[model samples]
Target: MGFKLESREASMNGVALIDDEGRWTLLHTTGERPQASPQIVASNSPSRDGAFVPEVRQPLGAVDMVLRFHVSARGGAASDDPRYVRDVNLAELTRVMRLGRISTMGLVIGGVPCVQRCVVSTSSSGEELSENIVPAAFLVKLLDGFWSAPLGEDRVAGFLRAAEGGSGPVSPVWRIEGPCQGFRAVTVDGVVCEWAGRVDVGQAAIVSGWQSWTVPASLDEWWVHPSAVSTVNVSDSSPVLPDFSGSYAVDVFVDGVKQTLATTKVSAYCGQTFI
Candidate 1:
C-alpha cells in the first residue's frame, strides 16, 4: 500500500519534528514515502498425538518500516551550500539517530492514518557532494502490532452483569471508536479489577469499532462477607441476606490523559431459598 512514515521529528512533506514532550526540534525535510512490511509472530504447540496447534499471542507485531529523509538548511539556501546541508542539517539528523529513543510514529497507509510506538533499530546516511544534500534512512521496529485509531473522545458502553437468576458467563461487549490505550480498571460495586492484557489496542478492533472481554466471577471479592455462619441449628433457622447489587465504573485513559467518566449499572443476586 502507498504510505507516508513520520515521527515526532519529521513528516514526508518536510514538517518540523517535535520532541517527546511535544516541543519543536531542529530536524526538517523528509523523503517522499516510506517502505514497510507486516510482521506476525506465532507459536506451535505439539500434542501427545503429534498434532500441532498454532497459538497467536498479542500485542501482535504489526509493521516494520524503513524511513528515509533529507536534511537540508532550515531556510531557503543555494543547493551548493555545504555548510547548511552538511554542517547543520546532517549534524541534527545524526544526533537524533544516536539518541536511540522510542517515539510515536505516524503511518498513513492506503489513505488511513494511524499512530504507533516504535524504536529506531538502525540508521544509515550518505552525503551527496554534488547537490550538497544529506540523505538518511532508518529502520524502525513497531513495538505494538496495531495502528492506534484516531485520537478523540471515545467510549465503550454496555451491561456488565447478567439478569436476575441468570447463571452463565458475563462477557461485556463495548463499542470502542478509533484506537485507545485500553482501560485501566473495571470497578464493580467498589471492587476494582485491573486490566491484565496488552496495552496497545489492535487494528482489527479499531476497524470493527467493537470489542468484548470477560471478567471472572472469582474477581468479585466484594461479594464475600467476613462474617458467615458455616453451621446453624436445625431446629431454629435464620435467613441469610447478602448484598449483590451496585453500579459499574470503568476508568479509561488515552495517551495518559483522563477523559470523561463512563459508567453502567450492575447487579449480583445473593438471596437464600425459602423452605
Candidate 2:
C-alpha cells in the first residue's frame, strides 16, 4: 500500500514497482539481484620505439540492473486454476512493463531504503507448468547514480540549513539533495567554486541522485585559489586559509525554483604549539 519496499533489517530485500500514474505492485519474488557494469574507454598510440601502449580515456559508464521474480498462481478452490492464474498475472506484468515509461523503484540495501527513477530495459516471462506458476524477469537501468535521502520534509529542511553553514575551516561543506542540474558555493568575501564530484549512495537503485559539496575540503587541484588571498603566507606560523568559510551561501535550482541557503556565523580555527 505504501511507496517503499518491505524487508527485514540486515538481510537481502525485494523491490516495489510503481507505474507512472502512481499505481503500485508488490512483486512475489524469490530473489532480487542488481549488478553494476562500467564501460572502459581506452586509446592506444605508437611510441617512438614502435611499441603501442593502451591509454585509458573514459572509465565509467551507465549501470544496468536485472530483477528476477517468481509469480504465483493461487486462488480459491473453486477458481483455483493454475493456468488461469498464470495468464492473469503474466498479463498484469506485461501491462506494467509496457505502459510504465518512467517508474519509481523501491528497494532496501544494508537496511537503507533506496528510491529512484527507472525504465525497463528488457523483461521476459515463462510458464512453469510443473510448479503451476510463472517466472518473470526484468532488466532496468538508472538515469543517475545517486540515491535520494530517506528524509521527511521537515528533516530535509533542517539538513539544508546545516549544510549551508559549511563543513571545513576554510570553506563551508554543503550536503545537497539532488534531482537538479548543479550547485555553487560562495562566501561573503566573493569566493566561489563549482562542484563536480560524484557520491556512491548504493547500488540498489543504480541511479545518480543528490551529492555533498565542501569548499576547501574538496577543492583539490581542480579548484584555483581566489585572487584576493592567493599569495598569503601559510607556513608553520600560519596555515593557508580557505577562501570561503563562515557566513557563506549555497545556491541550487530544484524543479525550476531557485533555492538558496545563507548562514550567519561560521568560524575557522588554527592549531598551534608554543614551545
Candidate 3:
C-alpha cells in the first residue's frame, strides 16, 4: 500500500506520498468509479408523446481522485522547531501538485502497481486537522480516465498477445522486425491492420530488418529499400475490439512462414490495471 508521484517539476519527481520521517503521510485515497462521458438523447428519435427518448453513451471521460495526506510537524525535532519545516513542506506540496502540467501517479498495493496520468484539481493542501497536523489532500483529475499497466507489467516481448480487459481499445506500439515478406496484426477487438510487400535486406544470408508499425498513427518511415507495396490497412468493420484476453491473431510472413523469435519483439500492452 504505497503511492508515488512523478511530475515535470524537479521538486515533485519520483516522490513518495507516504514516508516514515517525512511530513507528508498518505492517509487514504479515493477515486470515482468509471462512468461514460455523458448521455445524449436524440430529440426526434422515435420517442412517443411525452415519453423518454433513447440515450446514447460516450466513453468514460475525466475522473476525479483524491490523495489525502497528513502533513505534520516533526515530533522529535530539537527545540520548538518544525514550525519552519512544516510550512515549507506544505508549500512544496501545494506548488508541486498545482504547478505541473500532467503528472503520473503510481500506486502499488499487494505488490501490484498501476499508473495513470492526472492533473491536480482545486481541492488541495488547505485544511488543518489539529495543532501539529494538517490534513492536506491533492485532488487529481484524470482526463484520460484509464489506468494503464506500466510498460513492464506482465508483458511478454516477442509477440502481439494482449491480455484483454481495458477501459477501451488500447492501441499497442507494434514492432515489426524483418527479413520477411509482409506483416499483419489483428486486435481481438476485430481491428485488422496489416502491411504487404517485401522487406528487402539485400541477398545476405540470415539477415533481418526491423520496423515499428505505430497504431493509428501508422508511420512508414521505418522501412527502406523495400518497395511500398502497401501499409497497415483497415479492411473490415469499425476496427476491432476484442472481448477476451490472449492472442489477437498476428502473422509476420518470414519466408512465407509464421512468427515468433527473441531478436524480434512486440510489446503487447496487455492486462487491465485498476486502482
TM-scores for every predicted model: 0.39, 0.42, 0.58
lDDT of 3 by residue, 1-275 (tens): 23343212112235666654666676534433344243344454454444342322233468776666767676445665555667767776676575447877666523445566778766565656555676676667776655555442222333334534343434443334444444555433332434444434322111111223222113333222333222333232122234445333443333444445553422333454442
Q: Write the per-residue lDDT of candidate 2 for residues 44-126, one digit (tens) a residue.
A: 43434443322321222345666554555544255567677666666666565553367655555444455546676777776
> By the lDDT metric, which is better: model 2 or model 3?
3
Q: What is the model-wide C-alpha lDDT for candidate 3? A: 0.46
The TM-score measured for candidate 1 stands at 0.39
The CA lDDT at 211 in model 3 is 27
Point out the worst 10-residue segment of candidate 1 by lDDT.
232-241
Clashes of each: 4, 11, 7
Q: Is candidate 2 or candidate 3 better by TM-score?
A: 3
What lDDT does candidate 1 reach at residue 24? 20
